[model samples]
Target chain A: MLEAFVFATILFGFFGIILKKNLMMKIIAMDVMSTGVIAYYVLVASRGGFFTPIFSGETVAYADPVPQAVILTAIVIGFSIQALMLVGVMKLSRDNPTLETSEIEKNNTP
Target chain B: MNQITIVWIALPLFLGFSGYLLPKLDRYFVLGMALLSIAYGLQRYVAADTLTLELIDSFGVTLVVDSLSSLFILANAIVTAAVVIYSWQTGKSAFFYTQAIILHGSVNAAFICADFMSLYVALEVIGIAAFLLIAYPRSDRSIWVGLRYLFVSNTAMLFYLIGAVLVYQANHSFAYAGLSQAPMDAIVLIFLGLLTKSGVFVSGMWLPLTHSEAETPVSALLSGVVVKASIFPLARLALMTDDLGLILAVFSIGSAFLGVSYAIFETDSKRMLALSTISQIGFVLAVPAASGFYALTHGLAKAALFLIAGNLPSRNLRELRQTPIALPLWILLVLASLSVAGFPLLAGFGAKTLTLAGMAPWQEAVMNVATVGTAIVFAKFIFLPFSAQPEAKEGKKYTVGFWIAVLILVGGLVAANGIYMDAYTVDSLLKALIKIGIGWLIYFLIVQRFILKLPRGMEQFDQLIGVMSLMLVLLFGMMLT
Candidate 1:
């Protein structure tokens, strides 16, 4: 049930991305969606009354270790892409001081 | 270490580092790495054996040098090499240079990986590479489009992860060999997320805008070369689930029709090429949906077509409206386009034949519709080079080596068909002509009527493509239920 919450928040934020005209809002929405997804993985990783993972020598009540591992890689890749997007945003700001999300080189805007 | 396993992952890492260190050396390093891998991959491809090696603990990923992976891996290697030749002087930053090599490597990695978890990681690598490169042009729209892809792909990746956890629960194993029949619901959910990544449909709305807004060569790589990487998982899912055959058959056919509708209306030759790509991908997916040979054959031809389109548009074709031979290169590209349209002897013919052969009688209609769809879209594409007159007075002579490479590829494909299939008599040629005739008739009736000359007209087409995709998504939702 809580998984639905995280997904809803993510989709709501994406609507901000699609609806809002601000670039920062879009980036924030992107971050929001990423966090929602990460949370979903963590939650899903923990199933049943006691989520136990079998490990060598010592067994621990670990959530699905697979989601954790996968989410870790997703986080790293996400950070790099976020960095790339920020670089692009910085370039756009430099080229055109006002960064409207939908602007595509319209001369009349300025 | 088996040569296939080691070479697939390590060579790119080695090439990437060297390419990163030396700006002048990156393209060649990437080109060399792809060529080397193709040579190594071909051996396993011919052996028809599943090759493997562990890079770590029992937890380590296995490289499955089977027919499926080898076909995609070798095709990518060929595409990347041709890109190096075509982009001989593209002095983009060292960042993109290294990224391109890693991208190709990541793609080859995904194709060869045997374990579900390894395939997932490799897919993540490819997805990140896609995100970075899509906006690497550093333009305003490129950034926006890249973000669109970022949001959609990451979210899809989450669904894929959840799907993975479920699969683990159901099957109790991750090896391709261990992929016993997963529950239909689990398989369907996993593919739902993955379809977005692969740009098939439902999740494929990002295809045209992102691929089109990026720089030409990168666009080519994204549409032509990069899309194949994601097919690995989708194909695996299809192999796992019983219902996936029908799912693949239906959705790919929808993608084929939808992709063409957009392409026929697009004005920018580059973006039109991009739309044509989605439809071409539909063909590739359809082949594998039915059988293996189609997947292998279509992957190779489409990769070549994408790479060729990436280079040909370095100059907007608007200048050659009248001079028929203004760009003689178009003649060969037309041949490439012909091959993509499933004209007989070209590579697509063999693949399409197998795809159609595998289908039951009922499914042939779907295949035919896709063919006419491909024809309708590419008609816009084939006529584009000739639409502009010979007004390009720059008189820049194309490099001798460039034409040599193109001619060699064209000749090699026809000859390789004979070698690969062992008998390419006049029968193939006649078949190809018939296919071309069907495509040509569709163009005359439907596509030619709505012609747009400048990029502005394409904006309307993009919007229309957007609307059409949304409608299909709604329809697909009902169907999937």
Candidate 2:
């Protein structure tokens, strides 16, 4: 079920970037994509395993933990991209007082 | 030294942070400090070892250096030095952002890294830093360009992360060394998605849009070194498969030819520099595809070309002989341009000579054509300086440094002959001389003349061709594989 959500989020993010006219929506789409990929990573590895990775003390199915560790790095990457997008958005607004990609194109051409 | 690892992460971090800490330090100082840091880092990393990096592991990252890392470290440091100097030339008085400096340093930290997770962090930091540098001059257009770069690059990064995740799922480990232990072919194929992050155009669309639009010096870094940093990992992956190198070979020629073609037609100097970069990268890619040594040779030569390409002034070639570039600058420009053309006794010539000798089966003549195609394009550039008033900033403040840098680059190539020469028995001075002669012939006959649209058959790089590459890739990618 969570895999389904992750796939759906990827679509939402993909379309958000390709189809959205507003820069804000595009940034949000990027965020969605990042979240979806991370979700998929966790779901794929951590899913249903009867035997826990916990071999030390208990027979706990601790599940794979490497994906979780890797995800922390991905999360940081996502944040850096977000901060950059915001900076881009702020700069865009300062230049044209608008956040519309369409408007910027028109401004440049006209 | 093992201690050098933190300096890679810290120097830019320090310069970047200090800019914030001491807001009034002239931007030149920040830039100078960054240049000094990269030079020192490069000097030390010339012999840097691949060791267990504990400090990076706190963030679940492991920084290490091997031949691949050192090559990237050397290339990045060289370009960073050039970019910092150029940055100072233009914006020494303006309030340059500290973020840009941090971004540059952190990205270098990423390049020196050994693990996927840590590499991702560095990629993201570089992405943000790149975005801000592009948009810092502050116009609506700059912002949109920054967004476009951010969106495309980060999306590719996520794709790479997913590819990494899939590999991890199969292998249960995250370091590159560990990822190699996985046996799944499907997951290995997914690794191309990581190459996409490096920007190749089929799977990579960010190449044309992002790097082409960044500020001049920033564009130099983004094109000259950033794309290359990602390439080392891809090369590492290719080392795993015997056929993978051969498959990527076809794409390399196409990339080089197309990049040069676009550069020929391009008007803006920065955009032209960017196209030249893409073209040169085609050669860089071709090296690993042909042989690993080609990649190393291409890296050092191309990095030098791109770093200084920005500083050399240009005008259209048609009017060039009628007017003259500054004699000294013009001569320097010729030497640089010839180096790109693979003229004998220079860095590029040596690599081209080796590569020509290495081409398999019947592609030798075609490769020769491509070499001249590069010459044809550079002829356009070399003449540009003389066409109109040379725009090279007057009084050449760092003229000594420029000459020193050029000499070091030239000297490195001459020294490499002893190291790389013995591998290919057929490669010789005679072949090198022929390549130079052909390169010069093209410069004299066609490129130096009035713009006459040639019949499609005499085609040089990207022109008369690209409308066909999509179809070609469909067949080429499958056929080569």
**Candidate 1 Cα misplacement greater than 4 A, ranges:** A1-16, A48-64, A95-99, A104-110, B1-4, B53-61, B169-185, B289-319, B326-328, B379-392, B419-432, B449-481
Ten residues in sequence with the least summed lDDT for candidate 2 chain B: B458-467
Report DockQ per prediction, comma-separated: 0.33, 0.43
What TM-score fits each model? Answer: 0.84, 0.79
Point out the worst 10-residue segment of candidate 1 chain A by lDDT: A101-110
lDDT of 2 by residue, A8-88 (tens): 997688667767777777788878888898888778657656354657875666766667766876787688668767866
lDDT of 1 by residue, B1-481 (tens): 3754675577886788787678888877887887886786677667777676655643435666676666666667766676566667656677787888888888888877777677777777777777778777665567656756665666566556555655655554555544345444445446666677777753565677777777655765676567777776667656655455667777777777777777667655566676777776676677564333444445445545554555553434444333444456666777777666777667667666666666668777766766766766666547754533555546455555455545645664564454245324476556556766787897777656656643443232123223333533553574467
RMSD of each: 4.5, 5.8
- Name the regions of candidate 2 deviating beyond 4 angstroms: A1-5, A48-59, A94-103, B6-11, B23-62, B89-101, B178-192, B201-205, B289-323, B355-359, B362-366, B384-427, B439-481
Clash count (model 1, backbone only): 9
